[model samples]
Structure formats: C-alpha cells, structure tokens
Target chain A: MKPAPFQYLAPRSIEETVELLREHGEDAKVLAGGQSLVPMLNFRLARPAVLIDVNSVTGLDGIEVEDGTLSVGATTRQRTLERRLSAGGSGAQDGGWALLGEAAGHIGHLHIRTRGTVGGSLAHADPAAELPAAVSALGATLVARSRDGEREIAPHEFFQGFFTTALRPDELLTRVRVPSWPEGTRSCLLEVSRRRGDFAQVAVAAVVAMADGRVVRAGVALAGVGASTVEAPDVAAGLVGEVPRPQLIAELADDLCARLDPPSDTHGSAGYRRALAGHLLQRALLDATSPTGAAAAA
Target chain B: MDVQQESVVDPAAAGPAAGVQEVTIRVTVNGAVHERPVPVRTSLVDFLREDLGLTGSHVGCEHGVCGACTVLLDAEPVRGCLLFAVQADGHEVTTVEALATGDELHPLQQAFWEHHGLQCGFCTPGILLTAYDLLRERHGVSEAEIREALSGNLCRCTGYQGIVRSIQAADESWER
Candidate 1:
C-alpha cells in the first residue's frame, strides 16, 4: 500500500533536526524510529506537510543513571532498557518493582522492541501502553525541546488526557528522568489482554512501600482506565499504614475501581475493564508484595 | 524562529524535495553496491524487490506489523516497510539473497529445510534475516530472548514452534 504524498527531509544532525523543525513550524513532525508514526501514515491517520527524519541523528539514544535519577534518551530502544534492568541497573536504590523492566522486555516481541523506542512510546501516548504507566508511576520527568527552548514537565503534568500530551507543536521530547526507586517500594505491572503482544484491555502498575514489615507508602496507577493513566491515590491511601494483608489489598483495589473511567470496546466492556482493573490491581499488589519482590523493594 | 516547522506526514517528510528531483540512491545489497536514480517516495522494500530484483523481502502487511519485509540494515535487522530507500543510502543491506554465497545455502536456510520451518514460505525471508542477525550478533541469546525477537515475524502454518526451534538450533551451530 502506498502512503499519502508528503515531503521528506533527513537531517544529518540533531542541530539540523531542530533547525528543520524550526523551519517547518506546525506542519512538521519529527521522525525517530518510525515504528509508530510510519504505520499511522500508512493508515492515513496522520498527514503532516513535512517530516523531519531524525533516524540518523547521532547521540540521541542512550541511558544514564546519576545521583538518584535515571535519565533515558527518548530514542532509547525498549529492549535496551530491558537489558539494563536485567543486569540490576535500577537507578540509585533499585527499590521499585523490577517487573516493569520485565514488561518492557515483553513488549511486542523482539523486532518491535528493537525499533519501538521508549520516547516514541510515551509520545504516542497510548493509554493502554506500558512505558507511560511505568514512567508515570515512577513520577518521571519529561524533557521537550524546540527551537525556542527546552521545558521539563512532570509525567502527571505532561500527559493531559488520552492521546494528548502537553507537548507543543514544535516541541520534541528529548529524555525522561525517573527518580530513584523509593526505598521499601514494592511495585508490580499487570495486564489482561486478549493476546500477549496485543494491547491490554485493562492494566495496572502499583508500588507498595513497607516500613518495619508494615505498608507505609503505596502508589498505584491504572492504564486503559481512561484517557491517561490514573494513579489510584484514594485507593492506595487505604493500603498505606496497614499491615501486610491480602484482604486489605483486595479492599483497596475495589475502592480504586470506583475511580476509573474504563471505555467499552471490542476487547471488553467498560464493566469488564473495571473488574479487571480491580482484580489485576490486587494481583499486581500481591506479586509486588510477595517474597520474590520483597527483596527488590527492600 | 526564522524558519518553517513542517510536521510529520507532510509533503516534505512524505514527498520529494521542492525540486522533485530523482536522486541516485546507492545501496550495498548482499555485498554489492547498486546505484540508481530512485524517486524520493520509494520504499526500501520496493527498491529491493522491484528495482534491484531481490524479492526475498516480501511485503505482507505493507505496515511494520508483519515481518515479511525484514532486512538487515548495516547488520541490524529492521522493518523495511517502515524505512525509505533514501534512508538506506550508503548503508549495507543484507536480504535473503545474501544468505547463499555462491551455491551453498546458509546454515539457517538449511536448518529451516531440515526442521520444516516454512509451510507457506511467505515469512521465510524475514525469519531468516532476523535469525541471521540474532545468531550473528548474539551468539549466547537464550531461547526466551530468541522467541521474543522472532515475535515480530509471523508464520501461519508452522505454528512458530518449528521456526523458533530452527532459529535456536541455527544460533547454537553458527555461534556468530
């Protein structure tokens, strides 16, 4: 199938890429890995007047952890992050759920992982996607650059709503910085999709921090629940300060389900999604609090 | 601030330059460089199959979903449907044709034959290229990683078990 006609410009360097974006203004879109954008073009979903192909942009993809934060380039391939986590490279503390890294490894198999970059995934802003939730749960920071200047936005503030971000028309995401995994942070990522590679119908990411063998801090986020991932704040509130107990976790999940806005589609109904959200949230919390994850959290 | 910021999917990103010029794109395919005046809109898969007469890279989905058009870009396997021929300028491309040196089939090709890896053969080229890159680059890849890497390419008839096994066996033997 032929893509709709459009202009193509391959900028040799990042400076040139920024200049190209500056020249094209609102009609331009920056092309990185193209795993997401090209398909959208083929389907005729997005038709831009100019495409600044930055595949050749050197020094755009890499990951570095300094101090207490892990800074990952927007073009960093998902597999690369997965590999890093496999080697126990979780930022300063390594207290959060390492399950997120495993989930990163499972995204769309290996070929997609090779090309489906982490930045593109977040920029695509699919609510059912994994990285967004992973980053958001970690309270990450997104850095966007334009010819005008650069701006850093928190994950909660960066994501406006479904398929929507705070990114400007001329802005391009550069990197995402995730704070160190909090001490006593037990985290888990869970999804119930029709197929493994397919997008999940309902997914949940949670972190439960325990102090002195008691739950002291908890952060839970749900994807495919609404336009963007919703942190289960009130629900997690119920779990915090409680002793390690499965029934209380289940109760917290049920309370959290009431706050989600799941949309019905071919995959499952809104009601089903809510149910899955609660059940999966409970399961994820269990997995995160289990002995296997207990060590990581500690 | 004194320039135009064209968006993605624009005529500039999706079309020829303002002059509509046919630039000669040189690609080293299977260790041979072929230079031809290719339109700015041509896809790498088309350039390989239609222009260079290398049909090993099949286009199943025309999107990146199907691994039918998988090819090695500078020894790194990537989806050809998602790349433009111009992007491959001066890069080394290895298609299914590169598998046979002279008259001998590569070991991966032989493994497929021995293990019945291909039922329809539509996805054989992609599987071969992906396996080749994996075996060549990552000699010690685990079976789980091998399965995940090949997940992008689909096989309708072999149920993928045979294909995965074939790739595993090939990687062990080649040790590249």
Candidate 2:
C-alpha cells in the first residue's frame, strides 16, 4: 500500500507552481488535499515522477463573492465551503449557493472533507462525486492556469469522462466561478448512496426559477448515471415556461432515464442506477420547487 | 512560518528521478516538536508510527476508506494515510496518544471504557480522535449527529451502539 518513490516539491506561489508544472509536464502531479491523489498513489494506480505539493501555495484557498457571482478558490477545503453555506447569516443560502453546501455535506466524512479540496474533487472528475454535478448544475466556470496564462473552461468542457478532464498536464485548476441564479431560484441536490458519506449510487442536482407559478429557467444535472456529470439540458428545457407539477416531473424523469446509459458495477446494476437517477431527479425537482427548498437524502 | 526554505528542493532541479528522495520536515505531534527526514512517499501515519513511535493510530485500508488512520492535523480530523509525511511540515498533529493526561483517561476514553465501546479495540483509537474533533467543534451533539459524524469510521465490533453511547456520554462531560 506504499506509494512509489517520487521527489516532492512545495511551491510557495501560483506562478512557481505553474512553472514547476510546465517544467515537469506529464511527469508531475499537483498534490492538493491528497484526499484522492494519495489514495491513488498508495494503490500504485498513479506513479508520478514528481509530486508538487500545492498546500504551501498561497492565494488558492478562499471563497469570495463579487457582484453576485461566487468565486471559490480552487484549493478551498470542502469542509470550509460546507461551513460557510451552513452557517446562518453568511448570505450563502440567500445567494443561491446553498445547494453547494448540501452537496458538500454528502462528500466523504468530515475527516475526508477537512483535507479534500474543491478543485481536487472537480479535477478528479469522479463520475459519482457530488461537487462536479453540483457545479455543473450551477453552470460554473473553471479557471485553469499554466506558465503561459489562465484560461476558463465551462463545466461541460471541464468534465470529459470518468477520471478524465479537459485539463492539460501543465494546467492547474485555480478557481471555480458560479454565476448567481436568477432571483426566486430554488435548488436542491439529492443522492442515494449505499451508506452516508459513500459515493452516490445516483445523485441529482436541480435548480429552478419560477415566475407566476410557471418555470422560467431550470438547470438539472445528474452524477453516477453517466461517464461524466451529465447535464440534462433537454430535460431542463422541457420545464421552461411550464408549471412544475408532479406529473410533469415524473415525465421528465422518465425522459432522463431513457437517455442515460449508466455503467454497472458491483455497487449497482445499470438498470438500478437508471431507475435511481430518475427517482432522485424527481425528488430533487420537487424539493427545489418546495417552499422551504430543503433537500432530503434518499 | 519559520519553515526551512533552504531544505525545499528547487523546483527546476526536481526531475523524473526514480530514486528515493527524502525531505526534511518539522512537525509537531502531540505537542512535541520533532524534525526528521522522511521519504517523499511515506504517509503521515507511517511517519507517526515508525519515526515518532506513536502507534495508536492504526492503519487499515490504507486507501482512506477505513478511518483507522484518523489524526488531527492543525486541530482538524484527517486521514493520516491520505497525507504525505512531508506535507506535515510546519503543521500540528494530534494523535490518540495526546488525548489523556498521565494516569487519567480523557473523557471520551473514560466513556468508552465505561460503555464497553470496544471488543477487539482495533478501531477505537481512530474513533476516539474522530469523536474528539467532533466534540471539540460543538457541544451537546445529539445521537443522530454523532452517528452521522462517525459514518466514516468503520467499527467491526460492538456494532457501534456502545460507541455512540460513549460519545454521547463524553459530550455531556466534555470540557472546553
């Protein structure tokens, strides 16, 4: 279970870190929280020649809001994000970012979240991870940096497939920018995991905006039902300009299930995951449309 | 941060070397400071057990699934196996050994003993540290909250009923 031998470098600044990344290219791996990477390293699944520990790097671990847009530093601990959202009077709940906290709580236990970085989770791109689907449902933008410069990639582009991303070897994911949801927006993230804190068997993220009892805008995304965080744009579009009803939600969930070709593993069969995805999506949509907008786990 | 900057290898010089590379790290474990050279690949739990001689933190499922390697890094509970020893440089680590003062057991430890929280005792140390962090963060934690917080730590014996009671009893008696 020991990790392969490798040289360790802790850079003090983003520029130096990116420089190191540029120099080592594919040979180096950035060590953020090490919640995911170290496990892979210990299993000998990943054997990078150089490990760039980024915990020492400054300016990469804070949550900021400007002009109604939420900008979360890439290395911000998931626990920190959860605390901020759960802490009343932070305006996080009022700012339409509370769904992030809901999803963050579903991550591995408190011990894991204390060390897991948001950027690491997003970049890791696990098909069943909560943060990626949550961010995808929020229409977040990911910022990647290299020695050359910084570039922004939308969530759809950021998550390519299971454990794969659009990030280049030399690029370090630096920040995630979540645009403010339209006023009166309600959101929820619900999942069905075998056990609490375990990876979700199937999870759903839903954001809906209503005007005069009719849906004006909606964003829906699912995880563990596809190779990547699957955005159901067509399903979301179907909700637009329509009144959110139980029948409508049931039909949309059926459409989503039909569209999903989920992978089957020891945790569950493909059919089970597909059914779970549909059920969770329906529950998520109903919860989002609820007056309290509180999420309940399946 | 009075870190030894000179000991840090220059990023430019760090290449694709297959040989073992040891880095000097100054970490405070259980309120005692120690400086040691650890291999870059050595996990924090290994460093604690081997170098510091604090064997309370057990290593089961080194892949971060089992909470047997839980420890406090900077006063927060984290998987010791998930962190590299080198990453503990200039950080404070609290292990299970630090919970008690001399002959007297910590409140959690005492509660566990009184509640029969262990049978095999393999997963007790990690659970203690994890519970310590939880109690430190908040007072008057309910049963549901305690169960939720401890979902990560898997206890094979006692069926977690005694463990939950121990935490609840400790929470009532825990002092800031």
DockQ per candidate: 0.37, 0.55
Residue-level lDDT of model 2, residues A65-142, one tens digit each, is 878889999889999989887426374755358878878888999999999999999999999999999898888899
Model 1 C-alpha lDDT per residue in residues A1-298, reported as the tens digit of each score = 3656567777665667777777786887777777778888878788776777766666678888768677888888887778776327553247663544755764665667767788888888888888788777767789988787888998788878888889877777888887765576767777778865777788777777777777777667777888886776676677767776888887878777886779899999999999999888878888777657553233
For model 2 chain A, the run of ten residues with the poorest summed lDDT: A86-95
TM-score of the A-chain for all models? 0.90, 0.96
- In angstroms, how far off is B37's CA in candidate 2? 1.4
- Top TM-score hit: 2
Sequence-dependent TM-score of model 1: 0.88
Q: iRMS of every model, one decimal?
A: 4.9, 3.6
Candidate 2, residues B92-121: lDDT per residue as tens digits? Answer: 999999999999999899999999888899
Q: What's the lDDT for all of these models?
A: 0.76, 0.87
- Candidate 2 stretches greater than 4 Å from native: A87-95, A293-298, B1-15
Q: Which one wins on DockQ?
A: 2
Best by lDDT: 2
